[model samples]
Structures are given as C-alpha cells and as structure tokens.
Target: MDASVIVAGAGPAGLMLAAELRIAGADVIVVERLPERTGESRGLGFTARTMEVFDQRGLLPRFGEVETSNVGHFGGLPVDFGVLEGAHQAAKTIPQSVTETILEQWAAELGADIRREHELLSLREDGEGVEIEVSTPEGRRTLRASYLVGCDGGRSTVRKAAGFDFPGTAATMEMYLADLRGVELEPRMIGETVPGGMVMVGPLPGGITRIIVCERGNPPQRRTEPPAFQEVADAWKRLTGIDISHAEPVWVSAFGDATRQVTEYRRGRVLLAGDAAHIHLPAGGQGMNTSIQDSVNLGWKLGAVVRGTAPETLLDTYHGERHPVGRRLLMNTRAQGLLFLSGEEMQPLREVFSELIRYEEVSRHLAAMVSGLEIHYDVGSGTHPLLGLRMPRLELSADGRRTSSTELLHRGRGVLLDLEDNAVLRRRAAGWTDRIEVVTAAPAGAAPGGPLEGTAAVLVRPDGHVAWAAPGSHHDLPTALERWFGPAR
Candidate 1:
C-alpha cells in the first residue's frame, strides 16, 4: 500500500480524487507544480451537484459557511431548482482557490502526501501498474503506484505522453480577464450584455472583483502579445458606460477556451479527468465544476477496483459514463458562446431565449444545463426511479433520529433504502447486511411505516449516487450485489 493511486496536478480534480481515495482508505499521493496555494481565485462558481458532493462528504461546512449563492438564471433572469429533475439544480458562487484549499486541507487530514514544485517527467505503464518519473529540486526520482490519474489540465503531459488525441474546435473568440481592486462594479449584478460586447464581473471574498470582457469580432483567436491592461478597462467603460478611473488593477491575463476533448479518457493503468480529459469554453463557468464531477465519478470506481470490490470492467464504465457528459458540456458551452458572443444577427435569437427563460420549466432546464444537474445515466433500465439519480435529502424519525441523506453519508458507507418498508420488499431485502445499509422510512416520507412499493432497497454508492435498486424483493438481490459490489469480494 505504498502508493495505491498517484494523482498528477493539485488542482480541484486531483485534490478531490486524492481526498476521495484517502477517505476510501487508499494510499494516495498528490503532485503539483505550484509551491503554494495561489491566493488568486481561478474559476468563479460551483454548481449544485458539486455542493451536494461536498455536503455529502461533510466538507461543505468547513468552507467557512459562505452563503452567497445565485438562485436565479444564467446570462440574466430567474430560474427554479425545485422543478429540475436532475441531481443538482442550483449554482453556488465559490472560487477555485477556496475549493482547492478545502480539498487540499481535507486530503492532508486524511494523510495524503502532496508534493509541490515537482513536475512529472515521464511515466511507464504495463500490465502490472505505473512507474512515474518526476523532476524535483533535489533531482529526478521515480515512484510506483497501482494507478495514475492525470488531472493536470489541458496541455496535460500525461495525455500527450500517452498519445491521446485531443481533437475539437478551439474557442473562436479570444477573451481578456482581470481582477480589479477599488472598483465600482456591482458584484452581484455582474455578467451584463451590451450592444457591442459582454462583461462578466464577480466580487471575490476580499474586495477584489473579477472582470471578463470579450469583443464581438473576427479578431485573431490567439494572443501572442501581452494584453494591454488599460485597453481592457477602457473596453469595460465603453460597454458598461461606467467610469472606473480610480480602480486598481490586480492580475491580468488573456486566454481562449478551446472546446477540445480527448477521444479516450483512459489507456490501461492511466486515467484522465477534468480539463485533461475534456476542454471547453468557460463561458458558463462549467470547467471546474465538470472536472470535480469527473473526479467524483472516477474516484469511487477506482477505489472499488483497487479494493477488489469491483470488476476490471467497472473501470471501463468511467469512460462510458463521463465521455458523453464531456460532450454535453462542450455542446452547451458552444451554444452559450454563440448567444453571448454573437453580433446583431443573433440578438433576436438571444432575446427569444431570454424571454423564454421566464418560464419555470425553461429556466429550470437552462439552470440544469448551466449547473450540471441535468445528467441522468441510462445505467440499466427504467425499472427503478432512483437508479442513476442523486440520493435526495430526506427526513428521518427512527430511534428519535431526524436527519437527511447527507448526514447518513458521513460514515462513508452505502445505504439500503426501505422507503415506507413495504412488506413484500422488506422480506425480500432481508439478507443484504454488510454490503448494503438498511434504512426503513415511513410512507409520509418520514422514517418508518411507509410504503416501499415503487422503490425498494435503494443502494447508494460511496459518492452519494444510486448504484443499484430493487423495486421488490422479487428481483434477485444476490445478482445485483454481485454485479455492482463484486460478489462481496
């Protein structure tokens, strides 16, 4: 158990995978190029699914309890999460630095060895495992692990060395972003559209506020020269018609989002997640959220495989489940880019959708799209309603216990759900002891004395997702166990 998994890159994806692996009792090591955590915030927000994952892990509260969330719509207008059918429907505004910090600290608490200023130079993989080479201050050193994860982001050395093809269209527009201090921009009322351009502003924890501006033109998509800082502010002034002569500029950079995705996410013992696996525009702020979600999807499965609780075929599902998700993110971001960056010709279309967002159903749909809540896997069949859906928060009142699905997951074990405890189903689920937790709920959506007809013995995964379910004990529970949890090891 020297190195069960070696995670490259200490960004959100790597740190999250390290945290999950450590929690699953795996000897994990994290490698990053940065010497210390960057105080500058990267991405601007987190979706509901991301928050649910954090909440389920009991780490959300440790994020300093910042409750600044936008329950409205993206671009502009209003939306509703209650009407959405997916796992997470809301988007929470939190910076990348905060998320990475929380995950880094949590992984450290779980005793994950995090190496900084050390870049992976090479990796050799065979049927046995992976042999990784890294360049450190002292010199070069090699480490062996059962598996290696490349969360190293785009331009991933791991993906390149593995000879994976990242094929897709890069962003058509080049954008400039800067963090401003002493600015008069309204943080909450950010992301505005003007006649000639679009401005996205986000006020961070401190007085620093983020400003993103993109011109609607056919300018060269790539920037080789250092961006003119004054021009950026001037563009903001011209777009928003606001004077910010007194604002102090902090950090500035220019980047274009290339909507590229690798055809294969895994090759033998090496795995890719986040930007390493897929690249898309940050127009909707989906990059960080998507990457963290990718790690969440892969982490538990990898752990299951390492523990001999899952078949080798289980690893293949990582690509099957996530590749489509990456494609969807790219498509959605591209559509958003067209709407936000289009010229006068597209204004009518944007106006139509903008008006349509007023409807709860439409708003919820877009919210689900922007927040990463609309994902539902065709895992098996339409037999059970809870299968492949997120384990929703429910109330409990058994043994004077009152809690939610989030609280029950703190122990980090799967739960066997007996909603209302229907007699036939209860008798059928009597044998699933150690592998599945049994929780009887009442029909009133309470703890006990409820009917479990439509849903029976819902099995939640280690990552708070429904893995397997039986509407009745009539279905062979033993087979389901063998297929999902690998025959009790």
Candidate 2:
C-alpha cells in the first residue's frame, strides 16, 4: 500500500487526523484540492473541549497566546461557561485560517505527506484496501491505502462516491456574513433580534468588523460564488435601519440552516469525519470545533487497526460514539436557528427559554452542551462519575518530578494513571505497555477533592475519555485494557 491512510481535504479535520495517524505510527497522505491556503476565516476560535484536546496534544503553545472568554451563547441567549470546571475557557478570536496553518504545519512536521492541488477523482474500496484516483499537476495518479477518510466539507465527493446514506432537512432561508474595513459598529457579541430578523456585529483582530445578517423571509439561493457585499449591507439596513454601504468590503459569504447527518460514519474501508459526516447551521461556532474533534476521535482507533495492534471492530466504536454526537449537533443547531432566525412567531418561546436560562442548572447545562463539556461516552456500566467523560486535568507528582495527566497524553497513546502506585495494577497492564503509558503518580494541589478524589486509578483513551476507573469500575484492569487496546501479548 502507498500509505496506511489517505485523508481527503486539508481543512482542520483532515490535518488533525493526519497528525494523529502519524502519531500512532501509521503512514498518512493528505490530499487537498486547493493549491494554497485560502485566507478565508469562516470559523473563529474554538470551544473549551477543543482547547483541552489541543492542550493534551501539546499544540496550544504553537498558537501563541489565545484570547479566551467565559462568556458564551445558546441560540441568541447568554450562558456563563465558568460553571464547567477543570478545562480551559473557549477561545474567542483565532481565525480558522490560522488554525489550519498551524495544524498543517504540525502534521507536516510529524511526517504526513500532504499534497496540495491533488483533487480526488474517484475511489474504490476492495475487501483488503481502498484505491483512489487523483488529478495532480504531473498527471492523473492512483494511490492505494489501507483506509480512506473523507473530511471534505458539507458536499463531500467521497461521501457521494461511497454512497453513504445522508438524510436531513434542506436549506430553507439564507443569511449573510461579511467582514468589513473602515466601519465602526457597536458590538452585539451574541446577537440582537430586530423587527425583521437578527443582526450581529463583533470586532476582529486587524481593524476589521464582522457582521452577520439574517433577514426574515429571505429565500435560500443556489450560487457557485460568494454574494456581493452590497447584498449583506442591504440586509443589515433592512434589519437594523442602518446603511453601511460606504464601508470597504473585505469578504462576504452566504449560508443557510440546512442540517444533515450520514446514517453511518463508516463504509467498509472508507470512513467519514468532519463536515462529510454531518452539517448544521453555524450556530455558536460549533461547526469547525466539532469537526476537529471528530478527527481526534477517529484518528487513533484507525491508526491502531491499520497497525495490526487492534481488531477492525474498534472502528465500529467510532461511528457508535460520534454519530450520536452528530445527531445532537443537528438537533441543537436546528433549535438555535428557530430561536435566532425566525420571525416574531418565535418570541414567546424565546422568552420562555430566556427565563429558563436564568436558573443556574439550566444555564450550566446549556453552557456545557454548547462548549462540548457535557459529552460522555458509554465505556461500560461503571459507578465512577467520570467513567465515560473526558478526563479532567489533574496535576501529578511522579518520580520526584511534576507532571500532569494532560502531559502524559502528548504521545497520543492510552494512559493508565496509577494514582496510588499500585504495583499489581502495573503488572496487570504489563502486556499492553507497548500500546499504552503506565504512570504512577500522586495528586498535587487541589486535585484531591475534585473529580479524581476517590479514584484509585484511571484508564484514559487516546482521545482523552475515561475508559475505566478503579474503586468503581465493574470490569477488571485487563478487561478494559483488551477492550480498548486489543488483546494483550
């Protein structure tokens, strides 16, 4: 095979998956249709869960210092994100273009072969592997790999070529997004519902102001190119009675509230991630963040299977875990669209939601949902509170040195954190040492009374979710080990 994996598209999901596959010691080749990066920043910043994912991978410092905020929104209502403990706040202003550049650089440094302007023409998956035909500058070329993953945005060619079943709602109305120069507008960070529809204004890094306008009764349009800046300005004027036609246009685009998800995330040797698997309204900037995470969840499992360390059934868990997340994504974004983009008919429901959000529990739930802090996988029936949840960051002291649970995961391998230095536990996991890291450490600082308080030991998956915890798990150490890391040697 030319490579173990072939990832289509160089967006956040593709780049991240390539990096992760390389980390798992699998050869990867990434193909992108664009010869160079488009400097367009469709997604701005990431959620708290994405921040933790990047931190655990040791990629946060590469982004320099990010601007984060505890303030967040659901639909158009406000929610305080501070209630979620032991995670970084959501980043607010880093552009998607910047994120792509960083991820591409990291993936390349990890030895991923990224070929630009090599558009995938077709694909065929045999029983053993997958073959893809591509159009490159030199000539048409065919590459074979053990697996192929599609991260090629909403209208994915691979999804079509593989015949995956995608069923959901279609675009009903259109909204405009524009970045402008030489314009000063009051910041409506969340959004404001006007007589016609909703309008939002926020400041960007380089003296640029970003505005979103969703005028009621605006029908969705079919277009191959971006809408004119005047169109956005006209909608803004109609919604807010403000004319900003004199402002210099940086870039303008249009989007819709079309929601969709594939019935399955995998089809034989071909699998899907990012927008290829799901699509939703760009509410609360969840699209790009969720896409990045989809790659994270799929990367290591596919790598392990390709490397012969794990059974192919491990791939089934990818669909089982992320498909539900995608379903909830579509549901929440569709609900947000109704709340934010609808006419006056939605005001009563909006008012009711506003009142509900006033309660701390309601706000916390909404905040966690939107920030991705509330996701919990079904690892098994375990009494531990954090059994299926993402492992909280815990400061640790091992071998007279300070380390962390987050630091141990930089290698993209499973971690068996032995909090009490259990020699028997280490012996039980000895056979899987090649596939996981066993660290014996004691809690430091405020970690004692927190989430890890009663846990004697914890088993964390490569994607940072807890697979098992001692003093509560129903399964023994080796059972959880074989379940996630394959049978021991």
Question: Over the stretch 1-489, how does candidate 1's per-residue lDDT look in tens digits?
Answer: 349899999999999898877766678888887788876565866777787887788876787656645465554434555665534444455767777888888889988899998899899998889988898888998989999999998879899988888999866666778888887677533335677877777766678878887766625445556477787777777777877657887777666757899998899999999999998767567789889989988887787778766777888988988999999998887777777666678778867887887787887788777777777764566466666777776655544566666677775666766666566655554554554566775333554532234564576776677766766233465555555566553
Q: For each candidate, what TM-score against the reference?
A: 0.89, 0.98
Q: Relative to the unseen true structure, what is the C-alpha lDDT of residue 307 in candidate 2, on a scale of 0 to 100?
A: 91
Best by lDDT: 2
| Candidate 1 segments exceeding 4 Å error | 68-70, 74-93, 186-191, 218-228, 237-246, 398-400, 419-436, 440-454, 472-475
Tens digit per residue, CA lDDT, model 2, 1-489:
999999999999999999999999999999999999988889999999999999999999999989999988888988878877666999988999999999999999999999999999999999999999999999999999999999999989999999999999889889988889999999985558888888999999999999998887899999899998888888888878889999998888899988999999999999999999999999989999999999999999999999999999999999999999989989888888889887788989989999998898998899888888889999998799999999888888888999988999999999999998889999999999999999998888853368888789999999999999998999999999999999998
Q: Where is model 1 poorest over a 10-residue stretch in terms of lDDT? A: 443-452
How many pairs of residues collide in each model? 7, 0
lDDT of 1 at 168: 98
